[model samples]
Target: MRQSLQLIFTLAFSWTLVSCQTAQVKTAPEETASASTGQADPSRQAAAPEGGVPELTEDIVFNLLAGEVAAQRGALSEAYDYQLRTARLSGDATAAERATRLALHMDKSELAVEAAALWVELAPEDLTARQLLVVMLLRRNADVPVLEHLKAIVRISENKDENGFLNVMAAINRELKRESAMELMRKLVLEFPGDPRGGYALTIAALVDKDFAAAEREANTLVTDHPDWPKGYLVLSRVFLAQGDKAGARTLLADAVGRFPDDPFLLSAYARLLVDAKELEAAYEQFLRLEKVEQEQGDASYWLGLIALELGRDEVARGHFLRLLEIDGRSDVAAYYLGRIAEQRKESQQALRWYQRVEGGEHRAEAELRIVRLMVATGESREVFEWLQRMRIQYPDQVVRYYLMEVELLREHGTPEQVMALFDTAIGALPDSNELLYARGLYAATQSRVDILERDLLQVIANDPKHADALNALGYTLADQTNRHQEALDYIQRALALKPESAAILDSMGWVMFRLGRYPEALDYLRQAYEKLPDAEIAAHLGEVLWVTGERQQARQVWQEILDKTPESEHVLEVMRRLKI
Candidate 1:
């Protein structure tokens, strides 16, 4: 029964409290008289044991049952009030703890403070009560009260280990106000000068204050004083790293590794720095050493695989990833990378199986997309489309993305009519979808169906007047395929105003200006677009503008560069033929 009660507190109360109430400020003592009534406070009723409840009267039992039911029904504020009533009536430490957590959940700091104090007063030996009280006090920046609690915690840690105190300070430091925090840490350090952990805290405080020289000085002291402690080396290396002194960090780690040659963490740190520096071979060696020292470390194998992949040692990469998968079954990352390796080796079926094992992660969506692409590559186009349809229903949140993917696949391998039919289906489901409308407009423009293109794009613009891509598409269509140069300029100018840095829109504005015979302005926009996007299409437009502006030699040089970059580009051939080059 005690275990069950503790589980209820842990799952339903403590976890929620910990997320947002890492630390808090203390509050004024609870009112002696009740706010709702002029009667004296009620939680002064009686005491209860730590693990067992006291005998409660009818009213207290009713209120406790009501609080539980209210909490279960998601009436959090109502539940809190009921629990508050129960705490006041019963004077049970358990009731007070529940009230404290509920008040913190409701963000009622004063009530939380009162309840937490009651819990601490009833259960003075309970560290969790003290911790919660200290956190509440810290939240209000109740520095004097906080200092007393800090001293209590320090004493508690001294009975345990100094490292415990240092860890608590580090964990809660982010919530501390800067000056008061540094002052508190400085005081702690002064009081515990012999403790290397305090020195470490002082070093961190100095770093947080951006007093680099002091950080360096204090860090050096910790390193010298605690040569056997790996954390001292790690902290000092971070001090150098934060200041962009990578070489200094590397030198520091190397010196530490020499003294502590068998330290797996020190070796791992050195290997990571080597990877960051792109010294791949040295990093690989360090990881190898680390793996031998700590055989169960999957991260060592994972990094080894990554480095091998980078170096194009595919066989070695495959071995490491396969080993990692055997050791860590939930390694979706290893599964994803192994799928890539299989695809590279032309084992598409094996790759699909590997991708299927990926349940969910950052890589799950990418793995699914890769499966579709690979299916299409193997002439399973119909299968790929059906699979996407099932996935659209399976992952409702990703329906829009699946629709767009299907559209792209149809455009690549199916007829224009097929692409249009998919768009119709998608737009029927989401008639006002800007993405679908914009995609359909671009598709219509490619087919030279200007009326359909204009209708779709105009509908998009009506829905979202600031759609820059739609504006640019409409402008480029008018400028390229019709004699409406001035209308094109209006649309393109609006687009440029909205997205002045858009290279595609800049290219459209340039092309429209070129149609208007404004060669100088056209040349400037084209040059800007070309510099932003040095692709084959942008280069072709830039070369044509240069030729028209009488820079014939410069035009030849630009076209030559494009040909060298993409020797078989049909777009380059069309540009050359149109300009008579």
Candidate 2:
């Protein structure tokens, strides 16, 4: 009977356990049904933890059930409250962090802020939360949040990331003010002195205000510290140039070019700097280095040719210019220079051929001038009459000398009445023109009487002070024949000033001195003119000056050169007779 009684109690206990399990199972569906009924406080009745209380008393449970549904429905505020309560109840930091992040994603800005704050607490060194919060705060332009979050990041960041953080602060300061920007950048640079970009930012700020001294100092510091980087040196050089320290800038670039011999950016900058410094020879050498560096024939040849032409090394220039054309590069510019080179060599047919191949513009004006000048110079002016007449129709404003040349030719070829008619046709188009006055000046200069010549040459000088021919002729005529020594010197000096490279002007200066009886000075000027230009007139004048100055050997040499050029010329023979050469 005791065994049966024990068995019956075991059975009753088993049945009681089974009944409780069945009841719990039955209540889970009921709770789910109650939660699904869309009641306002539905979580109050939802299923809780396994074998736990399934009642409406837990505020946390109510939030959990409702929060998920509300979150899915875009109700982020409710979702955050539920996640916070769930976190407190379960004591799960990682789970809570996930829920907080979800809350942020659900369009709950206020809740997102709080969530971020809590997440930072859970994972105090979490860079994601710190960076995200800072970015969010900045996007909203909320100064309070931004400053607070940036401070948090800074405090947490290692000194190595100090510059990185300051980069953000500097950008914010751009919108905020200089004081704020400088405060952040200054501290960052102090802490992270190794970051050259940070130093550049400081320099950039100075450059913005044109503070060259500050910019140069900072840039030089960068170059000193980062000796291998060319940009720092380049930045310093630019700052120096912008401040008008061209010599300083050139020195800096020269050093850079020495250090970084083949760096294209450095080389190019240095070359351009040298050009600005009027160090043309150095610039040419650098340009040659660049051209040869790549063995790029077309480009190298072109730059070399251009610099040669600029320095007046035309024959040497033409070979490279022609070589560039052989490479079939954009040789229009080269073609133009080649034409000028040919014109200088007195190869008019070749010059005309090359110039005619070029299309029209300001570039073609020289070609057009070459055509007329060659015709006039060679006494073939009749062939250019139609060409000059056509130039009058086109480019009316800037026809270089067609009107003047035409007037001269007309005087020679036509009757006075016919010449006057031609002048009437052209003069109306060029009223108040220096060219017209110069044409008239030259015409009057070739006369028996001096009255018209005096008026016209004065008018020419009045119209254009730099009309070197008018100055030279007027002064030389006065000094040689009229004997106005002081006034002649004044006009010759002005002519020399205007046309400093003209051997003719230099010759005029020498002649005026000869008339003044300053023999040594006269010989000095004449010798320079003779060396510069081996022309017959200049040679004759130089020979006379040399004969007077007791330079008989040099005088004979000068006259001999002229005799070869003009065997029948009286000036050479007369000089030969005087020198017994």
Candidate 3:
């Protein structure tokens, strides 16, 4: 019943707003010009000041007529300027009002601010001028003076609605002292005892202060005063979420949703909460419902795509994102997600183009970094060096990617001193990064630096013993470089156990067994790995193992098979020719 009354009141207020132009007593210039005119002069009816001829300015009438002609003919900038001159010359309220609106329409912010401020200065009590002053501050920027001015208007406003009071109170809270904002609101509530806006303001203030008991008291008052409204219940839901009671939050939201079933705000927030809880399947259902009800909302399409992607429905998510881009082609978020999907598919050019769309938007820096990393991965990594140099200058502390890229660069082409510098930089910058530690361990093992490799790999295995790559690296390095056959076999077996079907890990296992003089077991694992991944490394491992398994002819044949494809197999040729086959 209270919501119905508020709606009726809103309707009545809107009617009054539309009907109150008459209530404001507008003095039309067209009427005065016609009243003063005995006859229309042919030259005074000339085209315009800038076009045909200048009008005979007997008074403000001629100026207004000329200004109207200019404004209607796509001369807004000139029209505003001329109207300002005319209003300044004659002090006409009607002319000043039109000039202020026209200046704003022309995107002349300073001129609009000046004219509106002048109007308010002339008539300090003019509600329209005072409201426009507040609007100016809102769009231009927020400050303490703006909040105080807005509060003054709220105090003097002839009427206040839920939205109006909320706007003023929110602006005050953002742009002024918090306590002052609450006190100003309390004064308004005391002034207008009928409107529930005061009680709502108190609820917001109490919520800001973290005084939940006071906020709940004020919210309960709003609920009692405006039983049909959903804002009161919405506030209560936020209070529950702030207090960390998810069940209580859900209950209050369900109540608000029951009351405001068709409200997009309620559905949007509820859908977000469901998404946050990792219930993607249920969240997708809610997004589908929201889209069914309102297919035009970008948020609905975006959420559907997000939930679909999280649920592994890649093609479905892609279609939804494409549709969303069609609806709003410049959405940076959609562009960024599409770029990531393209990157996952290894469509480098498509990924680059998609990321390029949001180059100057909010996601530009992140997209640029991703593109750099993709380039580095493809062996076209020279540009990443330049980007890293520039990033070191721009963002010295925000270390996300440059560290990894630097390590890769050093590994690719750097002296021992420079490589050690990268290691030092990475360690000092982020000592706890598992990937960095792993990188250092791999680099040391590749260079045959056994002491560093042993130290780092021991640390890695201590932290994550089942790390398959670390196991494979340490085992292969040990077996190939030293007489640590038993230790190599132990590490390789652990790695193979963790990733039994992994082609690379299986190759490492076969190589370690071959080192341990277990020819048959080595041949079996190598052949199985070759069947799974017919790579050059697998072929070489299987061929070397075959020679030891007493299949010299088959080993030679295998080595020949590998060389026949491109004639570039270093290990294959070494085994066949060095063994004198």
Candidate of highest lDDT: 1
Give me the displacement of residue 288 in model 2, in angstroms: 7.3
The digit string of per-residue lDDT tens for model 1 on 111-221 reads 788778878776665666767787777777645456555656666666665554564565347567666667776676676666678778778877877888888998999
Q: Write the per-residue lDDT of candidate 3 for residues 1-581, one digit (tens) a residue.
A: 01222233245345544553343323335533332121333333323344322232444343444455556556677567556555544444455677789878878777787778767764565666767766775567643256455555665563542245665665556544666667666765766677666687688778888988878788888888887777777777677777787788776776787778776766776777888788778778777777766767677888888888888777888788888888756468888888988887889888887887774677777887677767777776777777687877787764545676676666656687788788877777777666777888888876789778877777788889788888888888898889998998888889888999998888888888888888788888888888888777778778877776677787767767778885977777666666676
Shift in Å, residue 509, candidate 3: 40
Q: Give lDDT tens digits, candidate 2, residues 1-581.
A: 01222233245345544453333211222333232222323333324344332322344344454445445556555556655654444333443565658756766565555556656665566656666655455445534435455555555655446544544554455454565555555665666566566666667776776777777887878888888877778778778878888888888888888988887667777887777777788888997787666464466577678789889999879988888777746556677778889988889878877777666555665666666666776777667887786776786765646676666566766675665566556656665666665665555555533565566678788878788899888887778667578888999999999888889888989999999999888888888898898888888888888887788888888878777777887866766676676
lDDT of 1: 0.79
TM-score of each: 0.71, 0.43, 0.45
Ordered list by TM-score, greatest first: 1, 3, 2
The residue ranges of model 1 lying beyond 4 angstroms of the native Cα positions read 1-91, 101-111, 122-143, 151-177, 189-227, 235-245, 256-269, 442-581
Best by TM-score: 1
Better of 2 and 3 by TM-score: 3
**In model 2, what are the clashing residue pairs, if there are any?**
none
